[model samples]
Target: MNLALFFDPLADEAPAWGSTTLGAHAARFVDTFPDWRSADLALIGLNEWRGSAAGQPAASAPDAVRQRFYQLQRGTGPCRLVDLGNLRNGLTLEDTYLRLREIVAALLEHNTVPVLLGGSHDLDIGQFLAYETLDRPVSLSCVDARVDMAEEAGAHAEDTHLRRLLMHEPNFLFNFGQLGHQQYLVPTSVLAALEKLHFETLRLGEIRADVRQAEPLLRQADLVSFDLTALRWPEFPGYLPASPFGLTAEEAAQLCWYAGHNDQLTSIGLYGYRPDHDLLGLGAATAATMLWYFVEGYYHRRNETDFTSRRFIRYAVGLPGNPAKLVFYKAKRTEKWWMEVESLADSSVRRIVPCSYQDYLRAAQGDLPNRWILTQALLG
Candidate 1:
């Protein structure tokens, strides 16, 4: 595929980039588009915002983010990064989505993680659709201030995109989890509907209490879509319906770091940025820093997932339940946890899932961890 055909090259005037800055290391489109095949990560910008629920346009938001991102220093690693320039907006909103899906799918086939800088949260629909070609179920994690499951007639794309994704044909979604949702911003009925489906949800207070708890959830995800509206307005004021209370900028970066560290994660979308709403470009800087931390985490991955290797310590805890015992593995290198769960349909089939030390303690005390129960339920 001639991927260059789908993009419009960067148009911003070049600035003096420092020796150690990302602009110096990344392959960018100046005279010609960079070769994406050699990249470990590909940055794609979406310049379409017609689907936004706010009924606003942000055609230049992508470049606004790039201006800040290009100024940051590169992380410690072999920097094989490519800037594919901004995607050419199609004649219609759906056409743009199809173009995005094709580009993302192509990048995934080459084992290159696509980091999308989006105009609105709805653009994640393309990110989700890209996985359809894999023919395997995938887990998705979404971070937003409110659940975007509106089903009303004539609803805006941003407000109803999640509903469309969850109901997408072929149904390859294995698990869906959401974090940093402010309870007051969500409808009670919507929460009930999600709970009935056994989907995991963490309110803002739960995540704020301990950001580390969100790590395991992110680690399990194959793709993540983050809305900037999930951040507190004081720190990031670039999204409509801004709130005074949400995740701090540091907490947002931490979650992104965790997402990047996951070996299974193939794509991530940073959405809900509006340059018109920003003050002093702080919001763009915040998003750029989050991308920086994500890259840092990616380069620093420990690759400690080999449970059968000598680097792992295994433990079996006796239980009073029908399962009889719960088995866990702790990686000596990273001290990360994973627990085994037997499929109710076939006891011979087992799956190892990411967990935390607290879950191990709960199992040791003869109590089933909520994560264990949820996984088991999903398996059944």
Candidate 2:
């Protein structure tokens, strides 16, 4: 299967906000990574946003301007951009969402993760709706320095996405790495509402201290979002609202690794990459690093599952808990297989345990394996 979908709207022609450059970053890194030589990843271009359909257009100035939004960074790979040239500005958000969703849905049909890079974070409001075109119980994971949830108790606010999401009611929402957020950006009441919903949070300091603390939370989500601005300015020099105490590209890469490493997650979007404001290709290169990290984790984790034999069931114990004290219990489903880990001796570490495959298959799926082959495992 094609591993990922690289979609760039080229909706905003301005050099800084263009997802095209970000897409190039992903392609370049994949080419540079030694492990990705055989990976079946494709960077496909998406239609231009032109700002007319409904979301905020680049200028929000006129519907008639054409060729207004275009941004592509330098890179080496098979990166394709769907150049719609210039789109009319008169289009409404509803119109944009409807058409854009159609395009996104087409990509998903091919088992692709529609990258949908660019235009505005407001584009995410539409991207969320596009996922509705597929299965239910859709979830979203957003990584940013601030809570885009600024719409409660006030008519107007920055990050209109908070209000937009409330209106759409996505199945669930998980937020990570929100540090140094100001009340003026999002009111305290809004944060309270989000907290009530069980949104996962990783403050800058907390995540920096240990990213493994967020493993379980990342696993529970279905779709994830990454706001490049979440990184500290020194680490990620390409975002518009860069922060001083944010995630470096490597740390952010680790977080993305966990998200893509999960089995439940189905879609991911990278938003808020501003190449125009970048210094000496730092932003583009970091964005590429983000994609490389995600794709690497994605394929690596996926290959860990073994499905060839019907009767056997297999699972790997993740590397977070201490393995020295983990004890496996005999599974009830099958006499030959072992069951769950009975004790976790240390909270500071995590360990992945691979048990009898046939037993889990029988218990979890009511079937037993005729043969078994362990494709890969992450129990270290």
Candidate 3:
């Protein structure tokens, strides 16, 4: 595929960066686009913002984010990075989504993770659709201030994209988990509906109490979409309907780190940044820092999925219920945990799902863990 035809070269002049900076290490699109096939991670900037309620173009948002991202220090190890430049917006919103889907699918086919710098949160619909060609169900995770399930007349894409994803045909979405959603902002009916579907959701307070608990949910995700609106106002002032309360800047970076460390996670989108709304550049700096942590965590991955290896310690807990026992594995090196769930209809089929230590404790007390129950329900 001729990738250059779909993208326009970055508009800004390349800034001179120091030897230790990310700009010095990354292959960016200035005069030439980078070789994406060899890159471990590819950055694609979306210049289409018609999906936003404002219907205003965020033409400079990606470059604003790039300005801060390139100035950061490089990660611990050698980084194979590429900046593919900005995706040229199409004549219609759907055209832009199709372009994004094709680009993301191409990158995924090459086993390269795409870090999308978005024009709006709805672009994740394109990111999600890219997985359809894989011919298997995928788990999705999103961090947002509110669930974007708006069904009202003439709702903007950012407001109604989640509904579109959940209702997309071919039914390839295996699991959907939402993090950092504020209860008051979300409709009761929507929350009830999501719960009835057995989808997982963690309120802002639930996550803020212990951020580490959110790791397992992300660990199982094939893709993650992060809306900058999930962060508190002044901290991330570039997005609309700025809130006084939301995830702290530090918490947002931690979540990104966890997402980066997940071996199963393939693509991630950072969205809802508007350059016109940011005068102090705090939002850009925050987004840049989150990206930096994600890269740092990516290089530090342990590849601990091989449970049969000597590096893992296995434990079995007897249950009083129909499924007589629960099997758990703990990674000796990283201390991460996983539990096994046998299919209800077919005992021969089992799934190794990421879990927290708290889950193990719950099972030891003869109570089923919520994650275990949810996974079993999904399998059934």
Top-TM-score candidate index: 3
Q: Kindly list the per-residue Cα lDDT of model 2 for residues 1-380, writing each as its tens digit.
A: 22222222334333344554533333332222112223233332223333212333333111111112113342333333222222222255556556555655655565555544444455556566766767644546666667776544642322666557655655433232233233344567767765554444456666777666545446545656666777778876755545676777788778777776666565666666555566465666666566655555566553332333443444433333233222223323332233333223334433232334443544444332211111011111
| lDDT preference between candidates 1 and 2, better one | 1
| Cα lDDT tens digits for candidate 1, 28-143 | 87769898987999999887888975755544777888899989998898889999998998899999899999999999999899999967788999999999999998999999
Q: Give the per-residue Cα lDDT of candidate 2 at 363.
A: 40
TM-score, candidate number 2: 0.57
Give lDDT per model, in order. 0.89, 0.47, 0.91
Please list all clashing residue pairs in model 3, or write none if there are none: none
lDDT of 3: 0.91
The clash numbers for all candidates, in the given order, read 0, 29, 0
After TM-score superposition, the amount by which residue 225's alpha carbon in candidate 2 deviates from its true location, in angstroms, is: 1.0
Candidate 2 backbone clash number:
29
Question: Could you tell me which residue pairs clash in candidate 1?
Answer: none
Across 241-318, the per-residue lDDT of candidate 3 in tens digits comes to 668999999999999999999989999999988877888999899999999988888888899888999999999999
Question: Could you tell me every candidate's TM-score relative to the true structure?
Answer: 0.98, 0.57, 0.98
| Between candidates 1 and 3, the lDDT winner | 3
Model 3: lDDT of residue 35? 94
Global CA lDDT of candidate 2, please? 0.47
Evaluate model 1: give its TM-score: 0.98
